[model samples]
Target: MTITVILGAQWGDEGKGKLVDGQCQEAQLCARAAGGNNAGHLVRVNGVSYSFHLLPSGLINPTCLNFIGSGVVFHVPSFFSELAELEAKGLSAVHDRILVSDRVNVLLDLHVAVDGLEERELGDAAIGTTRRGIGPCYQTSRARTGIKMTDVFYPDLFEQKVRRLADGYQKRFGELFEYDIEAELARFNEYRETLPKYVVDGVSFMRSAQESNANIVIEGANALMLDADYGSYPFVTSSSTTLAGIIGGLTLNPKNITETVGVVKAYTTRVGAGAFKTEDTEEIGTKLQEIGREWGTSTRRRRRCGWLDLVVVKYSNSINYYTSLNLTKLDVLDTFETIKIAIAYTIGGEELDSYPADLNILNQAEVVYHEMPGWQKPTTNARTYDDLPKEARDYVEYIEKFVGVKIKYIGTGPDRDAMIQRP
Candidate 1:
């Protein structure tokens, strides 16, 4: 295949890093198309764990080239910090192996300060952002006033842009936040000195890669429910998290996209504030959280856990047109004697077949669940589809039938090898 996409079908933490890492060996290139350091992906190989916010997980494969597409908001501090951490883990050629899009917007110190102030302004109604300045940077980029990666290479332009943005922020926030322009300029200049080797025209590179017929994998950040257009309002992340985001970010031909793998947890978990229609809030939620380690990779905040919602998955399938589904954390559901899956939403007096975009309707909607029996046995070592216990197999089949997509990959554990692949 020339291009295969691995996307988070549920909320952000769907173990996409491991899924993308597993296929990196087959890909000639792996590119991250959207989001920023606000999203985190964890990949484990040979007993060592690798976590990435800006860099592609394919960095684990020394031979596979990686790119950060223009759709991403580039955070310089996080970028260099993550690269150094990966180098310490023995991936020493990272500086040469990766390419960053020159068109990507730069995340500045002022943006982070503004983000903190904005969240504080929200008070109890905060969106629970990671405070990495992703949203503010994106807002600036859309306004056509933000500094780009290319601009930072020129000292004069970089300084002017920094001062301009800092003055605007200082005027808006008053004493609530400080904008240190000189310090920021110094740090950015140092970054510009080191970033030259990694910079490239991402759109042109992707086009050339296609012409060369090189196999590529697009790794998506965040997930469908967090998408700006389709997700719950105000609580949603700032960027596109669906397939359209991939195409827009990379400037890729949609016809070149072969397989779109939608990764979802066996149940459901979401970080930050939003309307969780199926949230457990009780013992089942606690057990699932404890077993699944439902915590944010970037924020480390405990995610709100709930039962699998076919209503949500079915909605995601319609948007992405996934070729297959990668069901992760199934083993987390192994302890439950009885597990629930949300089949539809009960709104007021009537049941709805489709997910509603309105925050008010969704928040008021009740989950109509279908109960299933758990396998209660470990599946972490299962190597084949048939190796799974009968109850476990049934749960997978139930999700498949309901979502109208094949469950081709079953993640029984966190390790790269702890999965059953169905043909």
Candidate 2:
């Protein structure tokens, strides 16, 4: 069987959830590799919209095995809360389909407290995190003082670790909150009781899947441009959001990867703080925002919208080596008389060869735009590639040619049937 990785080519919210959900139809197993509840994935199936923070998007597909990989920093409360929400939505088989990697780092209340306090301390220079304890949890993991999914299964060891972390937080943040060690231990025990059925030796599980020729689809959180090591740093997330992360998280051979589909929106949008080189704060920008409903699924913050930044996507292609592209939100641009695309970045009047990683440089870089005729006509109902307006077809062709990657799937709307798949 084949394994494919569906990743965001732009900053997070490149409509990865819909693409991942679509890909689930052919796969036996689907897994999330990085990040945590900090990332939001919205998927609409059969007219009912579902939002995911901790669960894999593949949970919508009953036959698919959904997993949270070792690279994730899972918050126990959010995990259970999300499951409850899914149950209420009638997907009652969630428990049977989902498996949690025992090696995942756990995010505790103390970590969430520290996250908010730290962001507040940063004040005007804050990175605009989700305050979901992602940064603090990863920090503790790197510091070798973090808790794992399996840690809660052992009572004495779990209590010792919680006390140590609580003491550490108090010493570091000077009363971020009243973290009662005993109460926290009681909560941990509750989580431990329910976690046994879900927790698994993930590496072994994936290896076995591979051996059994199960088609696996890895659902990546965030995007390549938000990766801590390669993205605009300090303002970036605390995890790897690239191909390397998936391989490391799942303990899979790179050769097991048959395809890598980079999901991108028709225009650019990013949440949180970072340099947005092509951001437009004008009328067109606001129109796109209104039409596209450009708001963070988790934070509900308005996303900064602008022209499609090919320079950034080209740079992302280099990083992820995408085998194909899934162009999403094409309908968002239907009302524009003319569509603008940032073909290159000019810094100090000199064209840069690649997208800059340094926040300072990126903040100053000017977008070199290329204007194209807009389709103007709505494409949301188009089920085939030939059904798109000629102008829309041309726009897609231009992007495909410039990025040097074939556009395999085109997203016309937010629903499950809103995509056009090309041969």
Candidate 3:
């Protein structure tokens, strides 16, 4: 395949990292198309666990070259910090392998601070952002007042833009927005001298790779339910998390996209605040959370757990149109006597054809679930698709039937080799 994409079909933290890492072995190029350090992907290989933020998980494969595309909101501190952590884990020649786009927006510490202030202003209505400066940085980008990665190379122009960005926010929050411009500038003064080596024009880079007929893999950030345009309104993340985002963000040709894999979790989960129709605020939610480790990879917050929502999955399929699916964390339901999958959603006793645009309607929407027998057997060590317990297989198969896409990969555990891949 010339190009392959792995994106979360559910809420974020659907274990897209391990799948991306698996595909990386065959990929000559791996790229992150959008979002920022706010998105986290965890990949475990050879007994070492690597968490990806601003960098692509493809770094795990020494033979692969990774790129951070223009659609991403870049942060200097977090980029170096994540790279250093990965290097400490024994990833060699890290500096020589990755390339970043010059058109990307530079996320500053003030952006992070502004994010916190914005959240505070919302009070009980907060969106629960990662406080990583993603939203604020994107806000500036959209406003055309943001500093680009290319701007960092020129101190005078960089300072002018930084002052412009800071002054705008400073006016908005006044005394509440606290920032030390000179200190931040001093740090960038040092960064400018060393950061240019990894910079590249993203379009030219991608064109050259395609010309060479290189196999490219894109690891999407965030998830479908968090997409800005398609997701649950103000509660969603600031960028596109769909297939279109990858194409636009990477400056990629959609026709070259050979395959798109939707990473579907065994159940539904949401971190922070949003309307969760299938949410079980009772014992079931707790058990699923405990067993599934349903915690946010990016935020580390306890996710609100629920049964598998076909309503959500089917809606995701409608948007991204996956070529295949990967049902992850199946073993989390091994101990349940019964398992539930949400089949449809309704409001005021009327069924909706698809996921609604309004959060209010969704919040009031009642979920109709299909209850079935649980496997009650261990699937953690299943050697193959057939090796999985019959009940487990049934659950996976039923999901495949409902979503109208074959489940190609099944994640039994967190290890790189613990997945069962099907033909």
Candidate 4:
């Protein structure tokens, strides 16, 4: 069996954890291919909910082997803290299945400081970053001056490298923002000592697993629309969040991938600042926010709610070549009399079939909506496509037709069993 990639098709918060968990039961190895603690995956098991930032969703399944791939950046303290919490809940065994990749970049205290300072400098123009040090770490990684998990074992070398990087950053800070640096170095060393035990060389391990025909699932953080190469620029993540990212991150061949599942919400939601075309500024948006608990899992900030955008979904499907689609949070729209789906966009009176390359264009684009009657009746009892109300089925079909992607699974609630597989 080859690897399968699972990613979000819309602006994140797409219930990727539930979809990953559902498929992980049959997977031998499950790995997180990209992103850092900036992205969160919320999973519910045995009626208890757990929000994971650095850990793979497969950890909840005992039979599966979980790996944090090299493409991720590790915040050691946060990583161990989550591990301890999961252990306290008896969710995972310590030494048996979990593995950390050696090539994974390490996030230092200085990086966090830089992130805060940069964001503060932006002020009103800030992108509303989580300030978790992800962007800075990736920047340093690209510069080839960043530290990795493998460097932790060599204290003297690591300290020297840190000193050199600190000096350069201090010089830049002094010139740009006039900030002090000695205190930052001291704080970074303190954090360095608190890192937990972890193994390296994740690529080799994954290759071996694949050689053994292990059923592997590569999970991506964020979504295609937030990808650095394809997303809304200046507001995008530093790393690749698309299907192509899996190949480079895990050192896997294209032939190793057999299926790609794109997860999306029934409605659209985004945290922080960006161009949101179908945003609802009315009572329905507020109602959806309350019911969905639409908030950033990492920053705890309220998320901007909007109607589903099929134009972006079509773009996502084309980029990822998604084999299946998982639609979540369908129950959040239960109270609405009518639901709107953005079928296309109009800019300067010109109809647009796909997402615009310019962020400004997206900001000014008018959404062309297709209104459908809402299924006010509860769908919690509906376990199959046949069981769903005609209106609800019609809504799903409309989306399938618009996005050119088939809906394979629908999440009716937060529970694990709430997922309905469409035949």
Models, CA RMSD each? 1.1, 1.2, 1.0, 2.4
Q: Which stretches of candidate 2 lie over 4 Å from their true place?
A: none
The 10 consecutive residues of candidate 3 with the worst lDDT sum are 292-301
Stronger candidate by lDDT (2 vs 3): 3
Off-target runs (Cα >4 Å) in candidate 3 are none
Instruction: Provide the lDDT at 323 for model 4.
Output: 87
- Candidate 2: residue pairs that collide: none
TM-score of 4: 0.94
Per-residue lDDT tens digits for candidate 2, residues 377-411, read 98986899999999999999999999999999999
Displacement of the residue 356 alpha carbon in candidate 3, Å:
0.5
Per-candidate Cα lDDT values, in order, are 0.88, 0.90, 0.91, 0.83
Relative to the true structure, candidate 3 reaches a TM of 0.98
Best by lDDT: 3
State the local distance difference test value for candidate 2. 0.90
Candidate 4 lDDT over residue span 1-423, tens digit each: 867788988878899998888889899988988889989889887889888888888888889988888898888778778888878878758446778888998887778878888888889888777888899999999999999888866767777777777788888786554434456446456655654445757878877888897899887898998898888777778888998887788887788788888998999998877788888778878888999999877788888898998888998998999988988988888778999998888988898767888777888888889999999988873677777788988988888877787898999888888888987
Which pairs, if any, clash in model 1? none
Per residue, candidate 1 scores C-alpha lDDT tens digits across 1-423 of: 479999988877989988898889888899999899988998888888888998999999988999999999998898989999999988859888899998999888788999999999999999988898989999999898899998988899888888888888878889987777788888976887788999998889988988776889899999998999887667888999999999999998999888999998889899988888788899988988998888877888999999998888899888999999999988888778898899989877699868897767887887888998888888876889888899999999999988889998889888889888899
Ranking by lDDT: 3, 2, 1, 4
Ranking by TM-score: 3, 1, 2, 4
Candidate 2, after superposition: displacement of residue 224 in Å? 0.9
